[model samples]
Target: MNRFKKFMIFGALSVTLLSGLAACGKSEAEEKKSSKNADGTYEETITIDVFDGLANYMGVQEGWFAKIVKDKFNMELNIIAPNVAGNGETLYQTRTAAGDLGDLIIVDKGQQYNELVQAGLLYDMTKYYPGMKNMARFDEAVQKMNEGTDALYGFPTSVSSIPATSPSEGLEPTFGAYLRWDLYGTQNYPKVDTLEDLLPVIKSMQDENPTNESGKKIYGFSLFSDWDGNMLNAGKQLTTYYGYDESGFVLAKADGSDYQSILDSDSEYIRALKFYFEAKQMGLVDPESTTQNYDTLYAKFQDGQVLFSWWPWLGQAAFNTQTNLNAGKGYMMVPIEDQKIFSYGAEVYGGKQFIGIGSNAEDPERLADFIDWLYSPEGVLANSSQTSGSSGPEGLTWEMKDGEPVLTDFGKKALLDGDANMPSEYGGGTYKDGVSALNINTVLPIDENPENGFSYSYTLWESYQRDNTNPVLEDWSSHMDGAVTTMEYLEKNNQLLVAPGASYVAPEDSAEISTLRNQVKSTIVEYSWKMIFSKDNSEFETLLNEMQKTADGLGYQTVLEFDMENAKAQNEQRVAVSK
Candidate 1:
């Protein structure tokens, strides 16, 4: 259920320590006791303020996943949503300002983490759940880092429950361009080494399949305005080709902590914008790219009307849609020239959601224990095995076949083919958590899951066959007579890097530059889109000049100065640590 949304690499995270508030935690004798009625059933309700796509509870109230939670904790989830999104940013800010944030809360890392901690709105789990010390998926160090200077408050969620130190052996370009698989195959899978080089392939394919059998128009490349949240838009993915997280004011090469405004004719963003410009001139730009939201764009892709995806996950589901069944295909993660997947692992979190209990909760201890349990192997198993629907559904939600944890056929169907709206059908809270954020947003580690079982690996499920006893890594080996998958391409090229995304520059250093930073980023993106779409090269050049002038006039250089200082410090730390 955890997945990338725009920029979020969804997965649950691990544990930390908070000794000062330790008494609120259970005594040794209390650990054996469950907070249940004498009948051993949870009869209460706990409210949660959720964010983004997980707000759907239309039929999730009957989901079995929800039932498991009630059966274990004697309580049920009461889901809440903000009037607006950005992971409940407005709601959280408003609630924190008022000094209450429901019984439970889930927010993205960074800004929200700082806000809640600075406001003293979250409970310190160490005081209430000393038991976190032994959690199977616990991460004392990450928890400590997130805790900052205060007692640990937020529980890191939506991150790997267990850590894998080894580099990934696949070419899953979390960031980069993706093309509809069948189209690329038809073109003989030509190498696309740069953004400009990709233009012709898309145009050629669009020419061949200009319209679907239904006659809907297909575009060569499309963009989404929604992904431009907080300044950077989809173009940030282009920065990934250079192995850096796009901070707008700062840029680095190969994940080197050398920050500063590196935007130039040769910079990643400039190159990406120029590529878009060329695509536009060549009649390959989607008019919708400037007007549509991701939902609209995805709908087009779902119908196979989309020819190229700037972000890999944006078009993932579309490839598997029933409409694309005969035409059903996936996107090949084609690399741009010289681009390599940054070597990623524990240091770089794909993305994470942190969880926490409200400070005003009647009993923080129970909530803390519930979280600790979620991170434990047992908790992760229960939380993760929500028989499939959406994403990959080829494994058991949870089951034992001949002493091996295995996925059942029915379970796989429930995930892939089952109804998204199950609450109306199942009734009685059986599907209450089905298709909701709660289904994901908890801790679990896929790498640690065993073979011949229901692991969280999508590659395994998508390629899983009844004849294969060992499931997880076999997809690549089984394909095309031992031919590597897209992931294997990057692994073979060693493009992966340890760029855990520029946490090198601490938050405070950039706090003063927030306004200027936003101004510069907004201006760049504004012009980037315009320049790309401009009818004349002269007009495009004019906009580019204006964009730079506006940034310089707004003291963008001062912003870069601070970034440079912190980046040097961060790189120093990186060097020292490596040595």
Candidate 2:
């Protein structure tokens, strides 16, 4: 059947299935059962409306993990997933507005979770915490923050702990400033330790050789103006390097209290803009960068017309499919500045697409039981691995070996061994070729020590096997120690700023807040662009002042006040907890 018909059929079946479950009233025994399971371990059946992104991988329809759930926990499973077109976010908004929310809804975005909580659409999981002791193992700060006003709306999935290192100990973290190994030979490539080091390399590439086989000039780098690529790669990340902190109500501050909005006349801000403009003028950046989307940029990178660009490692894998550019030839995650990387911490719980129980659930206890079961060791394995027999249209599936959910042999071999010669899982259907040539060239050396003990464990368990341990682990204890020291220093000095409350605003305010934020951000973008393209830096001050004025007119101060209030409230709670 066509995809549309299939989706309709799936949707109807899911609705019917859920309705049937809802009709089955929760028995007293089930409530007692759920309560017991909540405390320790128990099992119950629950239906979940998940997005295709997750369902396609887990093989939910084929019931690959159902037998495990039934045998282990005595639970039945009902899954509702979109088969085509829309993503988790879109489907969630639609269902929420229609009041057709399922017993469990998996929300992916922080903003969305905040809005749902604010709207009272989600159950306060905090109330049930007495039954959920497993949650206690999570970070304390994260648990407290997610329980906004005593109502815990979601569970956090990814949270990185503070590293121990001085800010000045290593190179500054940077974005999109990597040397393209496929285009530039490793021998001639300069050891780029920082943004400053990249200047000479760009000049050499532009001045020395311009065109390749097709007569298209080879640019030193590709600059993207698209929001997803540009904001993530340069705007947000590179801006952070220049001391633009995102924590709590402040944007860019010269002193702790003196907020010199980045959209305004800040010297550091001006310098950053000037750098980009110079790169553009020197023809080091793609001229079409501002206009090109990711696909276009990917195509350019794949064709080897662009030598360097800022993008995720995943993107590199996706586009460079050709044998020459594939595997070891095309990509290398060259760290910018050789500095200790500090990734921005996303929201704790509500940040993930969650599976929330709806008020309409006939057996809330049963539903909660099912969700709890999903969190069990077996459930986590089933969801994460591709051992399940069914492979969805997305060409994604989970595999199980010896009852443990492991990546398909194809996936395991590719990532672990870096076997370029072995075709990817997408190429062959269930082909098991042992002794595939392992490509060891792509694996980077990792620091191994007590500080990185957890990371080391994860790498060993998931990525590397005991039999093949060529990449010897390095001593990263000092680095970890330094990172911890740095964090302690910042916290002691009250310099570990929190992200602005505006960052976690609900989606309900998106239209208005986004418009306001865009206006302010665009001013920064314009001034930065102008500074780069301008022959003189004289206009920088005037441009920044005008941008600030525009921002102030667009409720910048109001937003700042709101964020400050939220931060104050948060701090008060922290103080209370201390007592």
Clashes of each: 39, 38
Error of 2 at 367 (Å): 5.9
Top-lDDT candidate index: 1
Could you tell me every candidate's TM-score relative to the true structure? 0.78, 0.56
Residue lDDT tens for model 1, 1-579: 222332331221111212222223322323434444666344666543333223433222335555556556645566654422444444444555556655667655565565556555666565555556434344653555454454666665544433333432222445556777677667776777666788888888888888865798888877877556323465556666656654435665445744436456566667767777887887777887888866677778767788887554556545543323333355556566677554333333324456777666654655666677666555555454222212222233435556545445544444433223333323333322353345453533344443344445433443433432222224324432453555556656665555432223244434447666656767777777788788888998788788778878977788777766666655554554344
Give the CA lDDT, 0 to 100, for residue 151 in model 1: 64
CA-RMSD of model 1: 6.6
For residues 450-555, write the lDDT of model 2, one tens digit per residue: 2223221123233233322221111111222332222343334343333311113222333555455545555556655555555544664566566567768977
lDDT of each: 0.54, 0.40
Model 1 poorest ten-residue lDDT run: 9-18
lDDT of 1: 0.54
